[model samples]
Target: MVKEAGLGAMEKPNHKHVADSDLISPAKKAKKSEEAGCDTEDPKIPSGAEDEKQEISGGEEAIAAVGDRAAEEESSSCVSEEKKGFLIEAAAAEDRGGRQTMEDVWVVLPDASLDFPGKLRCAHFAIYDGHGGRLAAEYAKKHLHLNVLTAGLPRELMDVKVAKKAILEGGWKDGATAVCVWIVDQKVFVANIGDAKAVLARSSSASELGNHTEASCNPLKAIVLTREHKAIYPQERSRIQKSGGAVSSNGRLQGRLEVSRAFGDRQFKKFGVTATPDIHAFELTERENFMILGCDGLWEVFGTSDAVGFVQKLLKEGLSVSTISRRLVKEAAKERHCKDNCTAIVIVFKRE
Candidate 1:
């Protein structure tokens, strides 16, 4: 069973993009594309191709329409550390913020072994930030992971494309940015498309074993585990131009969408928007502390450094992962005054 152990608050959005008088408060928590094309038609990825793939190097052709390189089915780099037996814990949080509808959806499956049968022992976490409507977000939350499970749960990198392709199959005019993580024993796999981000906090030698004081917190490094995929990026812009797509003065694809890679943006697929995720994998060590998975709303006001420091401080104060996640969401929505729906998940790899 997927032990949603410390699940704080996760709600089912009405799945709309309109206002509601029943908008919930922060104290209570909960949860939750485009286009067509002319030149490059919609992607026709088969459902059972998870096995016949090679790990594509990052930044070469992560965009689906950019090349024919198939993504691998496992983490490219994973060193065994199962002997460490790190205690992993996770929690979730969300807020409507200034938005009428909550368009962010997330899931935490602490035991993904059932989904993969007799394969690797795995745990999964994901966040999807939706636009145009909450349908894409809701649909992706419910079905994307299932689709991935059906196709063998993706190696490490190619999972988001499966998610985006499944969401687009419904011919919906919505889109979503995805950030997902998988923990298989001591190995960590981070995958993302669009702007939703995953940040890992690594403690220094002193911070890992020292007292949870300000001095111990100062040495923590916030390592961003995923790349932002927006049209403004040089490589992304070049691909969009080559695909016969145009970026406006404001850096949006065809003067509409900002992210050059996402799910369910069929209209922008030919415009160089892709579903391929940049997957990163590594083995966890003692220096690793925790991870934060959040949408752009939280990121808009919370820098990676700011967030890591904030969480570390709260942890020193003896806050649980569940409370820390809720506080993080409130910090982004209330204190930071983010005008968009905010959601976050904090996963602690080894809690001392």
Candidate 2:
């Protein structure tokens, strides 16, 4: 069985007090790219070894300090464009959580704007899974995309590490996991922090099979795009130990948070927790089918291959992307009995 970090009990704080300033001016929040001394010309960020050392503090002051450091190390990049021929779809279902079944947030931008006049004929999908409270996730859902757009599309999209750093520095008091995918031209870019994940379905022989018959068609394979930042991972465990944080015998950060990296979580910043994201780029081909982004709630119940194969089976039956997404969440909640809030976004690339 796949071991995942459990969402422990946490007190909900005032959302307005936590994220009001960051959400009001989405453009302004993103514009900080300039103030951070980020270069608009080059978007490729240097490797992790060069990450700046941040000072430890408390409350809002710590958040401000991290933001200041993130700005100085930030960079941007752009992507080429081709005619768009894709169908995008997304849906999410929530498990009961007291007064609300909320805590999960997603964004879909089929016609996202680029630095130039004509919009980039690409699509962007993201999922933010909040822990403790919804303020950080809710704030990221509203402003992270805008920040990506403001820093310049395509180019900045590839610089997800810097973008995530910016979001963390944006004054969030809680923490949340994030996973996002950007489809541009014939390439797909994926970036993620913490455990929320993105998976791609690819089939080299898909074009050869004309019909949906299972026997005649090539099987779709799951390609996990992002690595989970859990304490069980050796590198993550080492990093926490070096930073004076302890990993429990059950594999949790300081025997508290399950994830080693996340947005917000001001309390854990001093213990080596970060918001840096892992970014990967893939060239699109005829074999490509679709992609899925979901929180740990879904992954805990389904492995990467299991989820991808289920979606492929549904596609063979000619089910729509929207229907597949809704069914995925429902199954996880009901059939698998996922205890946490669940959400998923599916983007299908139609072959013509």
Candidate 3:
């Protein structure tokens, strides 16, 4: 099990845009697409086809040989340390809807040398899911890290309890969900506002399971690092109600915003909606392998354990990080059939 800590907050400028509540009707359910299956065939060949088949096979082999050589050269040139102290792989994939731009923005800063007093090297990763428009998501992607870094380092922003106070004080507009992960040495810090999520996939320890066997294979466990802030959550709904924000019959914030927390949405700020994030800090163990940060579009269709299992299966097949991430986004888009944009980032921690 993953241990969780307190929360934090950040602010962003606001913008005017239609919240997701406007796009989706509460009464309607999205249709799930059927899984496609592959078809295979073995056709009979004539006696004279042997020579022709050999000629075609030789040509195909030659082409494949050239392609392999090119791939090898390209891979070598592209390999580099993403950050000064860590060897990491990161990738993002997005699928947009017809009317709107992909309202998903992600960031991967492998090495952010802060101006802190000590030898502090922080690697930051985040995903922002924009609701009304791309402005909030884009803005958060660019500024959220800076704000967190400023609060965490030079200013010593260590008090997590003050997150709510900061959000109430900050002025922000349009709304967007945010999930962030900051790595300093072996410690990992995570924060989230709204439904965007962060999950860690690692090997389960024998003690955690309370059982052990020498021949048993250790199972992989999915650790949800962030809590989703939506009206559906009891606490969130109560907070909204107390703040004069009504949870509509359709389960929206004042029948406008679907999420209960976000970076912008100045309109909902007074109604109890907040930009405060649930923050957690923990040390990364050798058993930990990778972490995933994704927008709700992915989570809507794939559960935490399901997503982790899918990625782990792909990793065991020797798939690269980028390929795994892109596949996940595509899978979510196809499965969810949701009108919302989809985005995901996969970060693999290499053994030093």
Q: Which candidate is the best by TM-score?
A: 1
Ranked candidates (TM-score, high to low): 1, 2, 3
lDDT of 2 by residue, 1-352 (tens): 1111122233333121123222211111211211222222222212221111211110111111101000111011112223545444444334432223345556666655534443345566777776545556656666666655554554323443443343334332235677776665555666677777777666656563223345125556666667777766898889888989888786766666677777666566688776666556556666566777887777878777678777777878887665677667667767887765666776766644
lDDT of 1 at 166: 32
Instruction: State how far residue 28 of model 2 sits from its true place (Å).
Output: 16
Clashes of each: 11, 5, 6
Q: How do the predictions measure up, each by TM-score? A: 0.71, 0.70, 0.68
lDDT string for model 3 (1-352, tens) is 1111111122221111234424421111111211221112111111121111111000000000000000000010011134333466666666542223445566666665444443544677867676544455555554555654544432233332332222222222234677777776556666677777887766554232211121024445667776777776798899888998888777778777777776655656688866656556555555566788887767777877788777877776677787787678667765556455666788876544
User: Candidates ranked by lDDT, best first?
Assistant: 1, 2, 3
Is 1 or 2 the stronger prediction by TM-score? 1
Q: List the residue pairs that clash in candidate 2.
A: 43-76, 43-77, 77-155, 78-155, 174-265
Better candidate number, 1 or 3, judged by TM-score = 1
Query: What C-alpha lDDT, on a 0 to 100 scale, does residue 33 get in candidate 3?
Result: 16
Off by over 4 Å in 2: 1-82, 89-100, 114-119, 155-174, 206-216
TM-score of 3: 0.68
